[model samples]
Target: MTRVALMVAVMAVAAQIAIPLPFSPIPFTLQVLGVVLAGFLLGPRYGATAMVVYLLVGAVGVPVFANFRGGFDELVGPSGGYLLSYPFAALLAGLAAGAAANSPRGRALAVSFGWGCAALAVIYALGATQLAVVTQLPASVAVAQGVLPFVVFDLVKIGLAAAVATAAAPAIASSRA
Candidate 1:
């Protein structure tokens, strides 16, 4: 519980690093990296809980969301879908990491990386679908606006998350030992 709280706090802080990108409202934030880290560290259930707590905090006007914006209005705004997907993405990533936890080192790394990619895909799919509905745009146009612009950065985030998880697994195991 303490670990989950800590992760939620960390993700809340991470959500504030908004770069305000020129082309899109999404901005270049480190929230996804934090989300992935939470998943890797806490596993699916606790990680998803952390993300939910983070979202709730923001929803209640804690200013813990992207660009330091918060409130119920933010939850229903254009970026709401992306924000809402955080817990699911963390859950998916955690499931992937947990499944790989008992595998060989190489296989574990592959699984972790693959799972990270899968999480990203799920996030984008949800975001694109919601964006299309919210903006009344076609799915392709929504993807072009929401997903295409962020692919490179998201891929980088996945790699970094995988590397961190790979390195930390041994420490986690030894500490348990």
Candidate 2:
């Protein structure tokens, strides 16, 4: 429960750390990095629970979402899909980390990196689809508009998340033991 709350807080702070892109409705934030890390450290159920808590707080107007803005309206807005996808992404990332939980450090890092990529892909899939539907834009255009710009940055975030999870795996294992 404490870890879950801490993860929620981490996500809130991460959302505040953002750079708005003039070309996109969604800002570039480290919130997803928080999500990935939450999954890697907490496992799927707890990680996803953290995201749910974050969303509920944001929905209740806690300003925990991106750009210090939050509300039900934000959840149903242009970036809503991305917001909604957080739990699922976290779940996937957690599973990914769990898969390599017992591996050597280098192998764990590599496996976790793959899982991070998969988790990010899940986020993009849902986010891009909704962006296209909401904006009434062509799918390719929507992908170009919403995803292409962030691909590189998100990959970097994934790497960081994976590295941290790998580095802490021994402690995490010991704790579980």
Candidate 3:
């Protein structure tokens, strides 16, 4: 519970580190790092739950989204698809992490990388689609604006999230006992 709440707070903090792009409505933020970490550290159920709570908190008018903006409007706005995809992305990452928890370190890392890509795919798909619909842009333009600019940065975030989660896993497990 404490861990879950902590993730929510982490997400809120991360959202503040936003860099708006002139060409796109969506801002680049560290919120994805928090989402990936929540999944890799907390596993699927708790990871997804944490995202849901975070969304609910934001939906209720808490300024937890990027640039300190939040509300039901945020969830249904042009960037809403990205926000909506967090839970599924977290769940996907957490599922792989949980499955590989007891595997060899190299194998676990591989799984993390693979699943992290899948998670990013999910985020991109939903986010781009929604951006297209909400902004009345063509799909290609939406993909160009919403997904292309973030790939390298997001991949780095995934690596960082995986490394931190893997390193802390033993300590986290022991603490649970």
Candidate 4:
């Protein structure tokens, strides 16, 4: 659909804002924001589908990943777990958004934030596990290097995503109607 394609394009643009860390292979990027937004806007099935399409697009060397780098290599690299977690994360977040539909704005925001945090937890778990496996590092080391550094930033991103989603979902739904 047009909206799904637009979200895929949004994710591609988000990947452009990458900041590589010195000690970690995972770079800071707005890809998570795009993921959260897709979930909040499109609901579970379509949100997850958008992520799958995005992954497929990147896997075929579309340069949609961070730093404009993409390929199957990106999906199997140290950061691959996080990359692969997108669909699940979007599904979880979309469920939260759907549950909060037609609720008061404050309640909707609360639900979005809670689910968004859960989604981030999914990303961290999958990402760290993969980082440890691919890089042959200890799990603690992987968590230390990969998950810890990003927590604060990701929390902020979740908050922002929740706010934006709560505010915009109604408008998006209306346009659909």
**lDDT per residue as tens, model 1, 60-174:** 9998888788898877776788888889999999986667787887888788888888888888888777778888888888888889988999889888988898889878667
Better of 1 and 3 by TM-score: 3
Separately for all candidates shown, the number of backbone clashes (residues 3 or more apart, or on different chains) is 0, 0, 0, 0
Candidate lDDT (C-alpha), each: 0.83, 0.89, 0.91, 0.91
Candidate 4 lands at a TM-score of 0.96
Tell how far residue 176 is off in model 4, in angstroms.
Answer: 3.8
lDDT string for model 2 (42-155, tens) is: 999999999999999999999999889989998887788888899999999999767887666558888898888888998899888888888888999888878999999899
What is the TM-score of each predicted model, taking all chains together?
Answer: 0.93, 0.96, 0.96, 0.96
Residue 141 lDDT (model 1): 82
C-alpha RMSD for every candidate: 1.5, 1.1, 1.0, 1.1
**Superposition error at 112 for model 4 (Å):** 0.4
**What 10-residue stretch in candidate 3 is worst by lDDT?**
96-105
| Residue pairs with backbone atoms closer than 3 Å in model 2 (clashes) | none
Candidate 1 Cα errors over 4 Å, as ranges = 174-177
lDDT of 4 by residue, 56-149 (tens): 9999999999999999999999999999999999999899777778677669899998889999999999999999999999999999999999
* Model 3 / residue 128 / CA error / Å: 0.6
> Which window of 10 residues has the lowest lDDT sum in candidate 4?
97-106
How does model 4 fare in lDDT? 0.91
Please identify which of the two predictions, 1 or 2, would achieve the higher TM-score against the true structure. Answer: 2
Which sections of candidate 2 miss by over 4 Å?
Answer: none
